[model samples]
Target: MKILKTIAFVGLFVAGTASFAQNADEIARKVHDLPDGKTSSFTAVITLIDKSGKTRAREIASYAMEEGTTDKSVLVFKTPKDVAGVSYLSFEYPDKADGTAVDSDSWLYLPAMKKVRRVSGSNKDDDFQGTDFTYDDLGKRSLAKDSVKVLGEESVNGVACWILEYMAKDAKAKVSKRVYWIGKDNYVTYKGEFYDRKNNLQKELVCEDISQISGYWTTKKMTMTNVQTKHKTVYEIKDVVYDKDVDPKFFTVSALERELVK
Candidate 1:
């Protein structure tokens, strides 16, 4: 009788652990869907401050949309006098996801050049437009495209975190692997580590200033660092309001040209 009772207790413990893992996986899956597939618009003010203390600032009004499995995005800059007419469209597919981005294809629209140029495939390691996030860093993955394994739990900045290991199931992925630190209560990602083809640590991302936007938890600022060159980029969103109706035309090429700052 003692042996039977002990076996039953162990079986129940195993079942409970499995259930906890499943719940954590489901919560992690929802983190990427905050944007959904809806067309949206926002005004962003970018401020670039170099290590030398030189500063450049621009206010941009733009629209974006993500569709289906393709995940196409367009950013039209309507801001500072110089970069006003600049625009770009990025079409991303989950080339790889092991808790980090390995590679992606991006096309930039050059108004003066009047042509679109394709960027790199494994360019996630590269600085984005001389800023912080690489092209691959902007790419997002749905849970269906990858597998998530619970890597136990940890504490980050006094917050409990569930470490999740995400791996691209696609055999042709450019990235070797990725790991994410997901907040236990809110399900927001606080940090991520990316690995290169040889599985070397290539990049790190830290997200801070989480706020409630449109009744959802959102990060107001994020910093991405490239370990290879010791370069860093910081992105901050201010004066943010959500659920505003965005005109479809705002996302088009015509809008990119006409919305130049005075």
Candidate 2:
């Protein structure tokens, strides 16, 4: 009878774990599917600080729109004469029909080259325009790309959050694992940590200045720090608008080239 009882307890524990994992996945989907508007635009100031405390800043205008199961965005550099007219475009897709992970596509247009070059998958881990953020960081990652688990609860910036852990499904992924602290009230991510293939902490990101804009919760300021190098980048959004009319062609590679000539 004791052996049978032990076996029953083991079964109960396994069932409970499976239920918890399902709940975690549901929460992750909610976080991923948070509604922004159909279209949005904003200007941001990106400041980079190096380990030696040296700093550089740039201004950029960003536009994004939702198209079916995909989200697209374009970035145009506005200031700093030398870098002006440069643009970056990205398209992020939802999970494949078979529920497999797929990386987003990104391209860069340089006025000097006058050509739009595709950003390859191998370069997704590289920094974006000298900023601490990687190309992957700029795009929305599908939940299908990772296996998620709830890591309990925590408080971030005085806001209650549900801590979640994620492990990449691909062995070649830039980040092996990630942890996110998502706000319980707004479902916004408050903080995140990234680990490299070697299982060492690579970067940390913190989101602040949360506000409701056009009925959607947004993070007005974000900072990402490369823990190993002690370099950081801070981005502040301004002049944000949602559901604004945007030219359909603006998201194309041809538009990226045309905008530089303007």
Candidate 3:
């Protein structure tokens, strides 16, 4: 009886320690690690699938500067000749956990239309290019801005992962709730669910085709599906190079005026 009790105590201790591990902050840290501020260039294939299951695909070349508060970024359409010179500029910031910064300003410049639009709290949920993903979904958020809570562990695609959830404090922010699955060993997010103001499952984003670049776990493919509309967008990354020299001007408003073909 004494030996059995001792074994039971040992089991409980192991279980307790495991339960205490894997919290929200850890998961947030992994997400923050996704992009190092270092520069890089890549080609992406953006596919749009409508509720009718019609798919439209476009190839785009993009350059990004992640170093500062500017979050200078630009995307230029490469294929589908009609979109040539269709470019955009934007500065993104990491949001605080409580989402209190709903008023934080982000800018966008469109060259084909020659318009620079600003995003505000009220219209943050507006779609980008009539796609399923909203502005806030593409917006940046610093891990320091939000508090993370680990919702425990589960297996995703046979990989053990930590489930984490986050909320923004600024009651008015677009996505009120988000859940993430962080791989146990790789620390890459494999799946996530975003909930809307009504706490309904608004969208689901899945990360796939993960490969290591510069010793970093990265996903070369991602898909965002809108549950409300049954529409989906697929993003495929190519020629991805990390910490390489990128032309600073590639991220400017001029990027919108030029046909950036590689």
Candidate 4:
């Protein structure tokens, strides 16, 4: 939900680590701690691409901010009349100190139903809207929930990266394990892989067009592809700003109905 985390970009999520003396827990923590600015706003052109390459695009205006240890974000569809006024709001909290996970609260607004549907933690495995991103992918999962291991090094786009394999401690987790290729150069997330409980590769997230904006490293473009379904969603970001003053109303459920962000 904050992903939009990282715009999925806002934090669709980053962190620093030292070369020597790094363990799986420490590395996972650093990766989990990756910097998403205090506040951010941007317009993302989301395109759904099928294996045949036919595409459909939708415009979404997204706003996100960090308040204390909590992160809040809102996304409203702007174009494609049918989906317009379709919005989402969420509150993501930091992990508990005891290493327990704190579930995120998210709600979806539909114009036809004229009611807001609350998205529960159980739906974390569900697709986000119709995109390849699952509800869980957009929120921050606690580090304590996973047993992460460093799978050694590899290169993505020629940049050295740490291959990390994260296996959920819970045997019944919808997603069995995830592999992340995190950049060693700046610790930027270059790519990610998601698998199901059956241990089959499910989806992949690849980030590109990374740049430093307003002194923060940001990923401007990303694609989430479903390996099994062969369907993909591409996010193209524009007008991105960090640490800007965001209206408090945007974070509320009322904003979802009011359509106040535009």
Candidate 5:
């Protein structure tokens, strides 16, 4: 009877754990599906701080649109004569195809080069314009790419949160694992920790100053810190509008070059 009782208890524990993991995946999906409008545009001020505490700032105009299950975005640098006219574009797909997971298609336009170039898939881990954020970090990440488990519940800045751990499905992923503290009320990720290939903590991300814009919750300020290098980057949204009709051509490479000429 004692052995039977012990086995029953173990079975119940396993069932509970499985249920919790399912709930965590559901929560992550909700977070990923947060309702941004069909079209959105914003201006952002990005500040990059190096290990020595020296800071450089850039201004950018960003536009995004939802096309079916894919999201496309374009960022155009507006200020600083040197980097002005530089732009990046990305198109994120929702699922794997042809028996392989699909990464976003990304492109960069340099004023000096006078041409637009495609950013290769292997370079997704590279820093974006010397900032802490990588090219992959800028695009929408599909939950299907990772296996999620609920770590537990926690609080971030006094707000209740669900702690989740995500392990990459691919061995060659830049980030082997990531932990997220997602707000219970808003379904927004308030804090995240990224682990490198060796499972070493490499970076931390914090999102704050959330506000409702056009009936959608939006993060107004975000900071990414490189743990090993002590380098940091802060992005602050200045002006934002939603559901505004942005020119479809603006997302094309030809349009990127034309904008550079202006």
Candidate 6:
């Protein structure tokens, strides 16, 4: 749920000690367990760009916190009067003791309808609010759902990276395989590619403006592009603060309907 409409190598043991540390399974666990923050607040600007070069932008104020083993987050729209006051709240749970995947619970509040709509698990592959990103792309998916392998290493923009590939265990999954270029030193995800069920490249994601924010490596800008449709979505993070005091009520469905996050 901490995701914002946002691998292991198995190569032979190289000569250096650092290269031997490139175990695929270990990198998968490390990336999945990256430390973000107990509480975080940030403003996200979502921009939709069509093939004709038209662009529409939406601003969302997002807050996230950890409650016990559950992670809670809320996105409240701020600008563009047509979408102002719209909010989305989600609760992400950890995997069960048996390693079964537990889908996140999400709800969306529509101001025009004055109603709350629940985002079902079946809609994970659907586009998130017409953007290029899908609901599954915006949530914390369990690592156990995929088989990760090391594809080797490469340099992305002069940054050394480990190329990791992931194949979804679910045969019917919309995304069958994914590849990522993750930073070796900081463990930050720098680039990624998503392949559809037919194993064709569907979307590509690039993370830029990487820097340390409150001791945490943060990607301030992300762009996701659809290869087939030529539609793209850009997310820009601003005014980020970690461990900020937040209202418990902000993560509630009732609060979303009542415009508490406004």
Best by TM-score: 5
What's each prediction's clash count? 3, 0, 14, 18, 0, 4
Model 3: residues with Cα > 4 Å off, grouped in runs: 1-22, 35-37, 68-71, 93-105, 254-262
State candidate 1's TM-score: 0.71
lDDT of 5 by residue, 35-63 (tens): 88999999999999999999999999999
lDDT (0 to 1) per candidate = 0.65, 0.89, 0.71, 0.85, 0.88, 0.87
Q: After superposition, how far is residue 167 of candidate 2 from its true place, in Å?
A: 0.9
Instruction: Highest lDDT: give the candidate number.
Output: 2
lDDT of 6 by residue, 69-178 (tens): 99999988898899999888889998889978888999989999999999987777788877888877776777768888878899999999999898999998898998
The TM-score obtained by model 3 is 0.79
Name the TM-score of candidate 5: 0.92
Clashing pairs in 6: 8-24, 9-24, 9-150, 10-150
Distance from true position, residue 31, model 3, in Å?
Answer: 2.2
Better model by lDDT: candidate 2 vs candidate 5? 2
lDDT score, residue 131, model 4? 86
Worst 10 residues of 2 by lDDT: 253-262
Task: State the weakest 10-residue window (summed lDDT) of model 5.
Answer: 94-103
Go through the candidates in order and give the C-alpha RMSD of each one to the true structure. Answer: 5.4, 2.3, 4.8, 10.7, 2.1, 8.6
| Candidate order, TM-score descending | 5, 2, 6, 4, 3, 1
User: Sort by lDDT, best first: what order?
Assistant: 2, 5, 6, 4, 3, 1
Estimate TM-scores for all models. 0.71, 0.91, 0.79, 0.88, 0.92, 0.89
lDDT of 2 by residue, 134-214 (tens): 888787777887899988889997999989999988798788999999888878999999999987999999998999998
For 150-182, candidate 1 gives per-residue lDDT tens digits of: 777898888899888777666566565779898
